[model samples]
Target chain A: MSEKLKRFASNNKQLLIMIGVIAVVFIILSLTVPSFATIRNLTNLLQMIAPIAVMACGATYVLVIGGMDISNPSVMAASAVFGVYCMTTLGVNLVLGTIIIILTGAFLGLINGFAIAKLKMVPMVVTLSMMTIGTGLATILSGTRGLPRLPDSFSEFFNKTAVIIILLAVMLIMDFILTRTKFGRKLYYIGNNARTTKVSGIDSESIIMLTYVISGVCAGIAGVINTASIGTARANMGPQSQILDIISAAVIGGVSTSGGSGRVRDAVLGAFLVCGLTNVMNLLNVSDYYTTLIKGGIIIGAMGIASFRQQQAAKKGV
Target chain B: MKRILAIVLALVMVFALVACGQQAAPAGGSNQSTSQQGSAGSPKQDIAEAAPAEKPAETELKHVKMGLAMQSLQAAAFHAWADYLAYRLDYEAEQRGYEVELVTLNADNDVTKQATDIRDLIAQGCEVIFCPCLDSQAILSSVKEVHDAGLIYVSYCREVSHDAQGDEVPDLTVNFASEEQAYAGMVDLFNIMKEDGVEPVKLIDCYGDKTDENAHNREHGLRRAMEEFGYADLPVVEVECGHWEPDVCGQNLAPVLAANPDANCMYSSSDFLNSGIQKAMEDAGMWHKHGEEGHVYFSASDMYPLGIQHLREGYMDTAVDQGCYNFAVHAAAGAFDLLEGKEVEPVQLVLGTQATYKDIEEILATIPLWGNDYADY
Candidate 1:
C-alpha cells in the first residue's frame, strides 16, 4: 500500500498539490467566513467562473501547441456585441445570431493561426493583433450599440440553470475529442516536437490552424454564455483583465507553458480552483490588491513546482 | 524564472509598504470652482418645466432616428445612463407626439471601433449622433464624416468640436457640462466634512482616466473646491484610476493607505472609485475605526447601485447622483427640439446637484437605494 501511495504521489504530484492547496484554502476560508461553505454560494461561484472556465479550455489548446491565445476576452466581447446586433438589427433569430457570431470568431482565429504558422509571426504578436482586430470589428459591427433589451423569451433561455449544465456538457464533448480523436493525437505530437511530427508526414500547419479555429469556437461559446449570464451583450463586458484570469486558471490547472503536457481534466480542475479562490476572497472581504497578489503568487508557484518536478524526473531518468 | 518572480514580488511589496506611510489631501482647487461660479451666477429659479402632456406651440413631429456611440457599458453607472435614456425615450416618445428610434453603439472601449460605429450609425440613416467617446480624435473624425454628409450630428454628455462651418451644417447641440458635475461633487464633499465638524482632515483624492475630458473636469472641480474651503493647506496627491476600475483603484489606494494612517476622508470622481476605496479600507480594517469618532469617509459622483447602498449604510457621506432619469428625459426633449427645427443653444442640464448629508433626513429618506431592479440589457 505504501509503495502504491508513493507511485501515485510522484506520478500525480501536480494534481496532489492542487488538491492540497484547494483543500487548505477551502478549510481556512470556511472556518473564517460563514458564507464559504454554503451550497448556494458554491452554485454562484460556478456561475461566476463559467465564462473564464470556458475561455481557459480554449487557451489550453493554444498552449498545447506551444502558443498562447490571449485574445479570448476580445473574442468574447466582439462575439457578444455582434451576436446581439444580428439579433436586433439584422432581424435574425437567436440560434442564427449565435451561429454567425461563432463563425466570425472561428474565421478570426483561422486568420490568426495562418499569420502565426504560415507567415512565421510570433504567436504573441499574432494573437495580440487579432485581439485588436476582433475588438474593432465587434464594436463596428455592433454599431457601438448594445441590444439594450433582449426579448423576454431570449432572456429567460439565457438565465436558466440549464445553460451551465449545457456548457458542462460541451466541456465533456471537448474533453472526449481532445483525449480520443486523431486531431488530439496530432496536437500532442506537434507540441512535443514539430520537426519530428512534420517529418512523420503530419500537416503541422493544418493542425495549428485547426486548433485556432477550435479556440475561436470556444470563445464564441463563452460569449453566448456571457450574454445569458449578464443578460446583455454589452460590448467589452469582459475586459482585458479577464484574459489574465483565464490564463491563470489554465496554468493553475496543470497546463504547462512549455507545452506537450496537460489534461483537459486539469482545465476543469483549474477552473474550480480559481472560481473557489475568488468566492472565498469575496466572502472574507479580502481586498482586491491582496487577491491579485495571492493570485500571481499561486501561478508562479505552480509553474515553479511543475518545472522543478520535471527537472527531478529527468535527473532520475524517469 | 524564480529570481525574476521574486524580484517582481519584492517590488510590489515595496510599493505597498511605501504607500501606507503617505497622507492624502483634498485635490488642489476643490473649493474654488463652485464657490466662485456657483455663487457668481444668480440661482436659476427652481421652477419645474411644463408637465409631459402639453406640446409647445408650433411643435413639429418628425420621425427621427438618433444614435449614441459609447466606448463601453461595463461601468454599471454608465450602463444605467444608457439604459435609462433608451427606456425613457421609448416610454415617452408617444407622449411627446413623435416617433423616435434610438440606437446605442458600444465601442468596446476601442478607439477605432468607436469611429467605425459612428460611421455605421450615420449609414443607418441616423440624423444626429451623440457620443461618449473612447478616443477624442476618433470620435472627431466621425463628427467630420457625419458633418460632411450634412447630417445633424451632435455630441452629448461628452463634448466634440465642430467643423469649419461650426454648428451650421451638423446642427450640433452639446449638453451636460462635465465640469459642473465635478465642481458639484467636490463642493458636496467639502460641505459634508464641514458639517461633520471634521477639521484639518487628511484625504485621498482619487480621480479617473485623466485623458477623458469628463474625468479631467471632475478633477479640476475638486481642485477648485480645495482653494475655497481653506483646505488648500492640506497635502493632496493625485492618482488616476482607469475609468473607474475597482482593481486599479485598489492598486493605487493600497499604497496610499500604507502611507497615510491619518486619512479620514477620500474624494473620488466617480462612484465606481468610491466602491474601490471602500474595498481598500475594508481590507485594511480602516473602515468604521479610528480618526475623530472612528469613521473613514468617502464621497464621489454618479451614484450607482453599490454607491447608493453604501451612502445609505453610512460608509459614504456625500455624492452627486447625475439624474440619469432626467438625463434621459432631457435628451428626449433635445432630440424633439432638433427634429422640430427649434433653435437649440449650448445648454447644460445640471440635474440633482444637491448636497446630501445625514441631517437632510427627509431627502435621504426619499433617495431610492435601487431603481430599475430588473436588469436592462
Candidate 2:
C-alpha cells in the first residue's frame, strides 16, 4: 500500500505541488483574515466560483487538444440573451429556452470548429472574429437593450442544489472521459503531434471539432447560470474580463496552455484558488487597484513555476 | 460534413438578412408616411406662416435631420434616456408643424466607434448633432469636423473639452450635475445617521468607473459632503471601485464588510452599485432598517426603479435623481434652438432631484423610472 501511494504521488507531482500552494494560500488567508474561515464566506465563495469553474472545465478540454477559445464570453452573452429572449419575449418554457441556449452555443462552436479545423484558418483569428460576430448578434437580437427579468422559477431552479449537483456530475464525467476513454487518449496524441495522430487513423480533425462543441456547450451553461444569478440578460452581460479570469484560473490550477496536460479536477482546484484569493482580499478590504496587481503577479508567478517544471522534466529526459 | 456545414452557414446568412429586412420595413413605412404628409399639406409652408415675427425668414421649419450619438444602450438608464429623448423630439417637431428625422447611433462604449458615428452623421447631412461622448478627448477632432461642416454640436451628461484645461467647450452643454447629486444623497444620509445618535459615521465609499468624468466628479462631491459633515478626517473603513458593474460591486464589497463589520453608512456612486452592495449586505446579515442594530444606512445617485423599490423596502435611505428625462429634453430643445437660429441661453444646465424614503412615492409618481417600460420594449 505504501508503494502504491508513492507511485500515485510521483505520477501527480505537479498537481500535488499545486495543491500545496493552494493549501498554503488558504491557511494564510484564514489566519490573517478573521472572516475568511466562516462557513458563510466559504459558501459565498463557492457560489461565485461556480460559473467560472464550469467554463474552465470546458476550456481545459480545448487547451488539452492544443486550441484556444477567446470567444467564450461573447458566446456566453449571446446564449444568455437568446435564452432570456426565448423565455420572456417568446413566452417559451424554461426547458425549451435552456435547449435553445445550448444549441445556440453549439452552433457558434461549430462555426469555430469548421473554420479552424476544416478551413485551416488560425484559431486565434477565427475565434476573435467569431467573438465580434457573437457580440454583434447578441446586441441586435436584444434590440440594443437588456432583456427583461426572467421568471422567478427559472432563477430559482438555477440556484437550487440540483444545479450544483449537475455541475459536479459534468466535471466527474469529463474527468472519467479524459482518464479512461480512447477519445481522450487521441486528444493527447493530437496535442503532441497532430500529423502522427491523423496518420494513425484517429480522425484528429473530428476530435478537435468535438472539443470546441464541448467548450461552446459549457459556455452556454455558464451563460444561463450567470444570467439567472444576475436576474437579467444584457448584450454585454459577460465581458471579456470573464474569459481572462477563466483562462487564468485554468492555467494557475495546472492546466498547460500549450495543451495535453491537465485534469478537470486541476481546473476546479485552480478556480477555487483564484476565487478564494479574491474573496480573502475582499474580506481584508484590499483596494481594487492592488487586487488587480496581486492577481496579475500570482498568474505570472504560477506560469513561471509551470515553465520551470517543464524544463526540469525535459532535462531529465522524462 | 463539410457540405452540411456550408448549408448551415448559408441558412444563417439568409436568416440574418430577413431579420434586417423586417427591422428596416417599419422605418421605411414611417418615412413614406412623413413624405405623404409633406406633399399633401406642405408642412414647411405652415411652419413659415406660424413663425414668430423675429424668426429668421430663411429658417422655415422643414424636415430637420438631427443626430444623437449615444455611448451605449447596454445600460438601462441610457436606453430609457435615449427612448424618451427620441419621443420628445418627435412630439416637439410635430407641435411646430414640422417633421424631425432623428438618427441615433450607439457607440457601444467604444471611443473610436463614437468618432466614426459622428463623422457618419455629419456625412448624412445632420444639421445638428448631440453626443454624450464616450471620451471627450477622443471625440474632440470629430466635433471639430462637425463644426467645420457648419453643423451645431451639443454635448450632454459629459462635457467635451477642446483643450486639456477645458477652456473651449461645445456649442451647448446640458450638465446633469452628477457629482452634486451624489454629494446631496450623502449629506442626507449623514443627517439621518446623526438623528439616529450615531457619531462619526463609518463609511464604505463605493465609487463608479474611475475612467468616467462623472465618477470623478461624484467622488469629489462625496468628499465635499464628508467635509461638510465634519467626517472628512473620520476613518473610512473601505473604499472600493465597483466600475459600475453589479457583480464586481458585490464581489468586492463582501470582503470590505467582512473586514469592517461595524461600518454603518455607505455612499455609492450610483443606484446600480447600491443594488450590489445591498445584495452583499443581505447575504452577510447586515442589511437592516434605520432603527435596527447593525443597520447600514446607504445613499446613492440615479433614482432608478430598483433604487426606489429598495427605498420603499427600507433598504436604501436616499437617492438622487440625475434628471435624465429633463437632460434629454433640454438637449433636444437646445438643438432645436440652434437649428431655428434662436438665441440659446444658459449654455450649461445643472438639473437634479433628491429623493428619500419619505418622498419616494411622490418621486415615483412624477418621474419616469428606468426599466418601468420594459414591457413596452
Candidate 3:
C-alpha cells in the first residue's frame, strides 16, 4: 500500500485529490439533500454539466499548453446563432446546420490557434480580442435580435440523456488524444517545455494550434447544446457566464495556469463540481448575489489548497 | 448707382412700416410675428402643413439636441418597442416642423460602452437625453451632467432620482406605469382563471430581476391577485430567476415543483420566463396533469404571440398583454407634445390588453403593430 501510495503520488496526486474532494462534497451534499441521490436528479445534473464540461476539457488543453481561450463562449454564441439561422431561415436540415455550426467554431478556433502559435501573441489578449470579434459577428449574423423559431425536434436533443452520453464519449476521445496517441505525448512535452520539445524534433506550434481547434470544436458543441437547452439563440445570452465561471472551474479542477500539468478528466470533474455546487446552492435558497460570492470563495479555497499541495510536492521533490 | 439707391429706399420704407406697426400694437395684443402674417385666411395653417417653413432669419435660437440611447435589440419584443418609438418621433417631427432631430444610439448591452456612449452624446451637445438603462446606475453619472446642463432628462424604463428640497418625487420618470401594467395583467389573469371555475388554485409564483421596477411590479401584481381573488389563504411558492431567460426560469421551476408538486397554477413575470416553466413541465412529463385538472396552468404579465400560441397548443393558460408597441407610441407622442408645445399629462401611461388563446390569433395578423422592420437599426 505504501508503494502504491508513492506511485500514485508521483503520477496522479492532483487527480486523486480532485476525486477525493468531489466525493466528499457529493457525500455531504447527498446526506443533506435527499433528492440529490435520485437518478432523475443526477441525470438532470449530468445533462446540465456535460456541455460546459466538454468545453472545459478543451479549455484544459489550452491552459495546459500555457494559453487561455476566453474566445470559447463568444465563438459558441456565434456558431449557435449560425446554426439556428441555417435551421430556420435558410431551411436546412438540422444535422447540416449542426455541422455548419461546428465547422464555424472549428474555423474560429483555427484562427485563435494560428494567431497565438504562429504570431506569438499573448493568449490572454488574443482570446479576449477574439471574444469581442466573435460576439459582434454573432450579433450581426443573428440580425441583432436573436435567431428564433428553432424547430421542436432540434431542441429534443438537449432534453434527452443522449447529450450527456455524447459529451462523455467526446471527453473519452479527448482523453485518448491527450494520453495514448503520439500527438498526445508530444502535447505534454510541448506544454512542459516548448524549447525542449522543439529541440527534440516535435512541432510545438502544430500541437498548440490543434489544441485551439479542439477548444473551438468544443465551444461549438457547447453552443449548440446551450441553444437546445435554452430554446433560444441570443448572441449575448449570459454575457458574463464564461469569464465568471469557466476560468474558476478550470483552475480549481487542477488545470494549472503554470501549464504542462492536468487531465481532461480533471477539467470534467471540475465542471461537474461547479454544477453540483450551483444545484446545492439553489436548493439552499441562496441569493444569486451571495451565490456568486460563495462560488468565488470556493474557487479561491480550491486554488489555495492546490497550491499548498504543490508546495509540499516540491519540498519532497516529487 | 441709381438702382442701388432705389432698393435701399424701398427696404427703409418697409422697415419704417414694420416699426410703425410694432409701435401701434398693444402689449400682448398679438402672438404672431410680422413674418408669420403672409396669409390671413388659415392659409398660414396650410403653409405650416405643406412646407418646411424657413427658419426665422435669426441665427440665435440655441439648438437643443437630445440623444436616445438603448441597450440592445436582442429581444424581438424590445425591438418592436424601440422601433415604434423612433418612428413616431421622426414622423411627428416631419409633420410638426420642429428643429428637433433624434440621434439614435445602440449600446448592445455593454454597461461600460453605454456609459461612454452617453458621454459622447453629451459632448455632442445633447440638451435632453433619454435612456432605457441597462442595470448599473452608477454608470449614469452622465445623466446627472445632462440634468446639470439644465437639459430635460428622463430614463425611459428605469426611474432616476434627484436630491430635492425635502420632497421626493421621481426625478426622471420612466414612460411605462410599472404598477398599473403589472397589477392590471395579474388581476386580469387571475380573474380569467377564477371565472373558469378553478377554485383553490395553488400558485407557484416566479419573477424576473428584483432590481428592475417592471419585474418588481410583476411580482407585487401576483401578490395582489392572490390577495384580491380570495386566494389569500392559498399556498404560494415564490422564486426570482433574474432575467426572462428560459433556462433560468426552467431551473427555478424545478425546485418549486419539488417543493409544491401539487401546485395547480404557475405565474411568471414575463412570457419568456413562462415559456421556460412550460418547457420544464413538459420535459418532466407532468404537463398533461396541468390540463387534465383544468386547474394547472401558467400565467404571466407581458404577453407575446408565442405565449398565445402555447396557450392554443394547450401548453399555457393566460398571459397579460402589455402592448409594448403601444407603450412606445405613447412615449413618442409625449416627446412630440413636449417638442411642439402641445399639452401632455406629466404622469406615466399604462397600456395593456388581456387575451386568451381563442382571441390572440387575431392580434397576430396586424403585423405592423408587432412585426420587425429593422428600420431603426
Candidate 4:
C-alpha cells in the first residue's frame, strides 16, 4: 500500500500539489472567515463552478493542442440567447431549444475551425474575430433585449443538483477523450511539433478542428445550463470578463498556455479554486479591488510554481 | 482502464477533501427573519409594529450585517454612489449608536456573477441586501432565494418584478423616475441653446447599450423631449450605441462625425461616455469650445466629473445629474431602516438635477453633485 501510494504521488505530483494548495485555502478560509465552513457555502460554491468548469474543461483540449480560444464566453452568450429566444418568442419546445443552443455553438465552432485549419489562419486571431461576431450576432438575434419568464418546469429541473451532475458527465467525457482516445494522443504530438506530427502520419488539421468542435459543444452546454440556472437569457450574459476568468481557471489548473501539457482533471481543480476564492472573498467582505488583486496574485503564484517545478525537473534531467 | 480508475480515484479524493473541510456556521445567529410576509408589508408595516418606540439604550444597540451588490464599478456613477454610500453608512451608524457591517461586492457587469454574488451575500448572514441589479428580471430567481432565506432585499435605482401577490420582490426600492432625468437634460439643453441664439439643426443621439432597461428608459426620455420641444422632425444624422465603454463611444462617434459633417448638435444618454465622444469630436475638428466657429450643442444625463469639467470649460452645453449621491443617501437609509425594523418607504423617487454651462459655477457651488467628489478624476 505504501509503494502504491508513492507511485500515485510520483505520477500526479502536480495535481497533488494543487490539491494541497486547495486544501490549505479551504482550511484557512473555514478557520478565519464567517460562514465559510458551512455546507450551504460549499454547495453554492460547487454548483456555480460548473458553468465555468464546462468551458475550462473544453478549453483544456484546445490548450493541449497549442491553441487559444477567447471566444468561449461569447459562444455561450450567443447560443443561449438564440436558443432561449426561439423557445420564448417562436414557441419552440424547451428541449429543442436546448439542442439548438449546442448546435449553434458547434456551427460557430465549425466556422472558427475551418478558418484556422483550412484557411491557415492564426487561432488567436480567428477566435478573437469569432468572439466579436458571436457577441454581435447574439445582440441581433435577441433584438438587444433580455428574454425572461422561462417555463417553471424547465428551470426547476435544472437546479443546483443538475449543475454537479452535468459537470461530472462533461468531465468524464473530456477525460475519456483526452486520456483514452488515439485522437487525443495526437493533440499533444501536434502541440509539441506540428510538422513532426504531420510527417508522422497524423491528420493534424482534422485533429485541431475536432478539438475546436469539442470546445464549442462544451460552450453550448455551458450556455444552456447557465441560462436555465438564472431563468433569463440576455445577449451578453457573462460578457468578456467571464472569458478571461475561464482562461485564468485553465492557467491556474496548470494547463500550459503554450500548450501540450494539462488535463481536464487539473482544469476542474482550477475551477473549484477560482470559484471557492470568489465565494470566500464575498463572504469575508473583501473589496472588489483587493479581490481582483488577490485573484491576479493566485494566477501568478500558480504559474510561477509551475515554472519552478519545470525548471527543477529539467535540472534533474527528468 | 487504468486511466479510468485513476480518474475515479481523483474525484473521490477531491470529494473526501470537501467532506473533511465541511463545518458548521459560527455561534452568531443568522439574519433570516421568521416572518415571511410580502415585501411591501414586511418591512414598513412590521417595523411599525415591532420597532422600539424610541432609540434603544447605548448598550442595547443592535448589531447588524448588510451587503451592497453593484453591477460594476466601471461607471463613474456607480463608483460615486458606492463611495458615498460607504461614507454615509459609517456616519449614520455612529449617529444611531448601532453596529453595522457593510460588505460591498462588485459583479463586474456579469448577470451570472451578480446572481452568485447575491447568493454569497445571503450565505454571509447579511440581514439586508442592497443591489442595483444587472438584469432585474434575471435576478428574480435569486430574489426568490433571498426571500426563502428570509432576508430583507432592498433594490436601488431600478424597479424590479413583483411577487406573486403583485407586490414588488424588493422589500423596499429607492427608484428614480428613469425617463425624467434625460428628459430634463434635453429640455434644459434645447431651451438654453435657444437663449444662446443656437438652433439644433442636424442632430446626433449617442445612447447606451440596448440590453439595459435603464438605457431604453433614457432613449424614451430623449425622444419624448424631442417631440415636446418641436425637434422631432429634425433629421438625426447618427444614433450611436456605446455599450457604456468610453473607447466604444469615441470610436462610434468618429465615423459619424466624418460621415455627417453638417451635424451640429448631440445628446448623450450618459455624460460618463462624453470623454470618448469628446475625443472623437476633437479628431473631427468639431469640438470647438462654446462661442467658437464649430462648437456643437452637447447635452447628456448624469453629472460625472468629465461632464462637470466640460460644462465649466464651455465645451459641453447641458447635463442632467442622476442624483446618484442622493440615491446613495436614500438607499443607505433604507438599508439601515430595514435592518433596524423601522418603517421604510416601499418605493421612493430621488429627483434629478440639470446643469447648463451658463450656471456651472453657481450649481457646482450650491448643489451636492456626486461628480464634485471626483473632480480630481
Candidate 2 Cα RMSD (Å): 23.0
* lDDT of candidate 3 over B192-221, digit per residue (tens): 666776665477777665435567666666
Worst 10 residues of 4 chain A by lDDT: A301-310
Question: Each model's RMSD to truth, in Å?
Answer: 19.4, 23.0, 25.3, 7.5
How far out, in Å, is residue B291 in model 3?
Answer: 58
Best by lDDT: 4
Poorly placed runs, candidate 4 (over 4 Å):
A314-318, B1-58, B95-97, B161-168, B196-199, B340-343
Error of 1 at A240 (Å): 1.5
Q: Compared with the true structure, what per-residue lDDT tens digits does model 2 show for residues A146-259? A: 355665577678763655765687788887888789988888888778888889898888899888888899889877776655444656556676677788778866677777
TM-score of chain B of each: 0.74, 0.80, 0.72, 0.80
Off by over 4 Å in 1: A1-13, A314-318, B1-377
User: How do these models rank on DockQ, best leading?
Assistant: 4, 1, 2, 3
Indicate whether candidate 1 or candidate 3 has the larger TM-score.
1
Interface RMSD for all numbered candidates: 14.9, 23.4, 33.1, 8.3
Tens digits of per-residue lDDT, candidate 1, A193-230, equal: 88999999999998898888888887887777666553
lDDT for A89 (candidate 1): 82
Best model number under DockQ: 4
Q: Cα deviation of A214 in candidate 4 (Å)?
A: 0.8
